[model samples]
Target: MKNKKPKKVFMNGAIPPEKIANSIANHQSKTSIGAHSIFLGQIRADEIEGKTVQAIGYSAYEEMAEKVFHEIREAAFSKFDMTCAHIYHSLGTVKTGEICLFVFTSSAHRKIAIEACNWLVEEIKAKVPVFGKEILEDETHQWKVNK
Candidate 1:
């Protein structure tokens, strides 16, 4: 957990799994929690209606994304006995099979942490103003949206 409130946002650019993993492992300690549930997101190359996705470009409204994320974190904390929460999302271009989002929630017990992790992801996806552009193998592109 943070010894002090994070002065700046955790991540607002390309997300590195190692950095996120290390941060989670470092942030939550024995005295702070008993369990940590992590959700790692990876980009996938897939064919959609005969078009293969080659890459994705992620963009976010920083102010809005940050505000929504903070609210989601606070809500999770109030609804569950979570110790802490960390969220990371990619910015700029991300190629196929690369992660665009990572969320980890810690608690004193397994069940709460698991549920919080799930909830946090959905909340971020629904509430954040993050846009994605799917670049096809043929170099064509389309925008991605929640279905």
Candidate 2:
């Protein structure tokens, strides 16, 4: 069996659109891949009570999160014929409309790409011990939980 190396899945802040574009551009040369599915999780400017959320200050138990991410990656590869996969999650403040999570999966067919993308996202949300502090416009904050 070939040894699979772990990938770096954490970014310091909000994910840039340029990074997503570059990732797509980088895969153009891999002719075997026919489909790509991308999932971007954006911070919402949600109103709670009377305050509007302006940003989310994210933090994580880095080591454990990375391990879970790697496990999810491996599971996706085993369950699907994926050509490549990348998972990135924010580690700090991500403002409203900015991306906090990015999951990119490519495969020879659309089904594999799409399924793997969704699976990785659900797994990450359910398993990762990442915390978020929702920063309201009033400068107050509240803990964010995935729903």
Which one is best on TM-score? 2
Candidate 2, 1-86: lDDT as tens digits: 02488889999999999999999999999999999999999999999998999999999889988888888889888888899999
Write one digit per residue (lDDT tens) for candidate 1, span 74-146: 7787788888778778888888877778888888888999999999988887887888898898988899866
Give the Cα lDDT of each candidate.
0.78, 0.93
Q: Count of backbone clashes for each model?
A: 2, 0
Measured with C-alpha atoms, the lDDT of residue 117 in candidate 1 is 97
Flag clash pairs in model 2: none
Q: Which ten contiguous residues of candidate 1 have the minimum total lDDT?
A: 1-10
* TM-scores for the candidates: 0.87, 0.97
- Candidate 2 residue-wise lDDT at 41: 98
Residue-level lDDT for 124 in candidate 1? 80
Q: Give the Cα error of residue 143 in candidate 1, in Å.
A: 0.6
TM-score of 1: 0.87
